[model samples]
Target: MKLKLLILLLISGYSFSQVKKPDSLQLFFDSAKFSITDAHKTQLQSFFKDIKLDEVLQIRIKGYTDFIGNHVYNNKLSKKRAKATYIFVTNNYQFKAIAQQGLGELDEEIAEATIEGGNSKHRKVDLILSYEKPKEVSVSLTRKQRYLLQLPKLSIGEKLRIQHTNFHISTPNITNASKEDLEGIIKILKAYPKLKVLIEGHVCCGDKEEYESKIINPDNLALSTERAKNIYNTLIKKGIKANRLSYKGYGFTRPLDFPENTIAIQRENRRIELKVLRK
Candidate 1:
């Protein structure tokens, strides 16, 4: 009866503590055990869910054991313990973690040994919440930023077209004017690292053949494909993983409006579209 009350108190206390800013916390384990109790694990997972950890940031996890085994064996056991928690987090949460470590056994002289139920106190893991500090630049989201934050909720088939009139002209060159827009995109990708997108390039239909013919390439696809590739290159240069992004071109093949429409509409048709492949 007393044990049940203690667990109830623990769960309630942790629930209250979550209202504050995230600080480092420890999750204790049983002797020779890597798995946390269902109650404790549920509490830990709830804490992570309550927080808004970006998909890009890597989580730090460390495991330690009691001074009951040899150093070599304890190290290996401690690592397994850490890995168990690591797998649990990755499988359940959106965040990616890298700093998984096993500190072997805790020194008995330095810390209190968990004497109640085998050395349970020292046999435990710690989760240190950490984040990558964004570059100190004053960046405010405009009304247009709704596209980035709310995009994941939209239909998967919807293609998000990016407009950079000053950057991607009828040609493939990307200029300084396009950098600001591209920077915003990079920030979005970083915030949601798990997202994958396909960059599609489309060109205005011209009187002769097609706008894709503007650039001659033996492969028969130019202008449009190059434009898409240019945006892909730009994102890669900005440190976004290449696997998360891809580029393709469809010269005047997919038109939103009539091909022979007003210059404004024509320009709209010729655009770089981000087809969100996965969230």
Candidate 2:
């Protein structure tokens, strides 16, 4: 317990110096248009790309709409605007958002305009970011921390994942322990519902051509592909939203810490790599 508290203090010490990237950003739609503009798309891409490595403590995206339309229409429009931005962010950054809400015409006293392209400012979505902070001196150390604590802020093109402890060379199954480990990731996704991830499956034994020839029963290509798909399905079966996850098979194409000579290294190769696509 003392060691755990010491580690928490150390992490909190580092977190105290960290700041949220962007702090706040926003997306605007054309009048009566709920879709994000292409210009805005480039802006968002550039903005998030710059902060790819920053630790994202919390993501909040709030959407708003002008009062030009009826209360019902405006409220729905605001949600659409927010959803578009949420999808865009998740598809690109793969960061799960803490909150995604539509404040439909809330706090707006604008005179309703019937003309086209009226009240552009209100048709917008705000992307707010929050950073980690140190626990108060008075606060007690606890094992239960935010879900983000267990996750690494995935880089744009970099591959990352929690290793499955129960993987077998003869099986294409995700073991019980592996499923439990994956449940931690589900919590992270729940915290950031709008986030999207690309799951890549890689296998060991030999290169692509070699696996095609050597591996019997289901082909080597199928082995990796099935693993990736199973992870994707497991998340779905466990009630994770389907739209947020994608999987691909790269059978022995991408290797880490090369010279995969040992059994441990080969096991490392037969693993899943989660890449951020939208956050």
Candidate 3:
């Protein structure tokens, strides 16, 4: 019992000793549009001087926007702001800062188009310095595992998904779909009730010669549409709202697993993809 207590005390002490103070910085924008200024640069230099930038540290810079524009646009603007700050740090300070990121418009201290107590704090950049290395913080996932579980983000409005937008919709023969795959899709819809999905279907051709022309073949549309319509009907029969669902068949135009030009590749091309339009 005494040995166990001693070990616990030593572990706790080591953990406590690793903790270091992080530096905080705030940059404000007063113009209609945001821009990085000389004052911001000077403040950053002063802050870094107090802390040791020579020591290994990770710099996290986040940009925030007001609620004025669309969320997607605001998110992009925030990234730009963050990148600008990172460039300034690297150029002026001549230090290799790792992992610069933008948080976009997610965090806002002030309301857009509204001033409280004669203060508006929406357009700004937040800089943080951490002594922790990134390797200790990143989580790893294998390629096969990540691909099997990919899904688009469902937003209440348009452009809902943030990742994998290129894979909007796809369809393959439902007859060939495994029971497990069907159940997995049904599970996704049931778990997220507000989700509106658009299903697309595709068909595989044995020969790469099929796609020789700029124009698409009519059979491609027929096969793709058939699979998509079937899936849409199934979901409706299962009690999902008809208004919340739509389907389109691209035939062989959109392949999920394989590139065209061979038989095996064509088989992969024939698949189904579900896109979330609303949540």
Candidate 4:
């Protein structure tokens, strides 16, 4: 009876170990439309909701268009689709590494058949996520301390937003309220001697022209960059090594909230974030 019980337990363990989670997803779009629909957005949220950032190894996205358009048009459309998906994923989730490519039109035979059948599969983006299962470990630490420990494990391109790290209006000056957050970051850097990061600054509420045309109003860009530099300088002042840090400003280009219609949303957009470069 003991031998039979042991065999049953071993078999169950092997079966559990062999269980596989899905590694790929396909998101469809309306004809010639690059934007993700509400339905697809909900699907995406459900798909990614359970994924842990630390376990992700890489994400690759590929966009494809139907054969109804000319090569040039289809190629550009595919790129737009890819960009839209990429932006949505990056804004919503944190991951180690991600890459996107526009594969343009589907194969001619497949496109023709799909079109004849009124299928929309060709107008789609494929997202392939690869990750490793993290090992189970028991540790007793405060939430902030655990976050500090995880900082060193992040791969390049992964970002950690410094919550409440906001600045004075239209200036690079750090707000008094944000000092504690900065100190927390400094503590993490001091704890992990080999960790390196790039400070990124962003702002909110700008017109399309202001966002795109640097020549028309370069100050926004400069301001953002300076904000990041302010954080870099503060870290240096706090005794973090200068060689382990770099900074850049993105202005109003990467807002967390689009249109910037509300004060609260705009406040969320106007903040500083850090990208892990080395661990």
Instruction: Write down the TM-score of every candidate.
Output: 0.44, 0.45, 0.42, 0.52
Writing each residue's lDDT as its tens digit, candidate 1 over 225-258 gives 8888988998999899999998887666444445
**Once model 2 is optimally superposed onto the true structure by TM-score, how far is the C-alpha of residue 210 displaced, in angstroms?**
6.1
Cand. 4 Cα-lDDT: 0.76
Count of backbone clashes, every candidate in sequence: 0, 14, 7, 0
Task: Summarize candidate 3's per-residue lDDT along 140-211 as a digit string, tens digits.
Answer: 334322332334332221121112212223433344324445545555566556677777665665233443
| Residue lDDT tens for model 4, 1-279 | 999999999999999978776687889888999997888799999998777767778888888887665544676888899889999999988889998877666654445643454447788888888786444334444454455455555544446667768787878998887776777787778767778998988877766665444332477789989999999999999999999999988777555545567999888878787878777
Q: Give model 4's clash tally.
A: 0
lDDT of 3 at 235: 76
Model 1 superposed RMSD (Cα): 20.1
Global CA lDDT computed for model 2:
0.65
Give candidate 2 regions above 4 Å deviation: 1-152, 208-218
lDDT of each: 0.68, 0.65, 0.57, 0.76
Best by TM-score: 4
Candidate 1's C-alpha runs over 4 A off are: 1-140, 143-146, 165-169, 207-220
Tens digit of lDDT per residue, candidate 2, span 1-72? 999999999999889767545677767787778777789899887777767535776787777776564444
Question: What's the lDDT for candidate 1?
Answer: 0.68
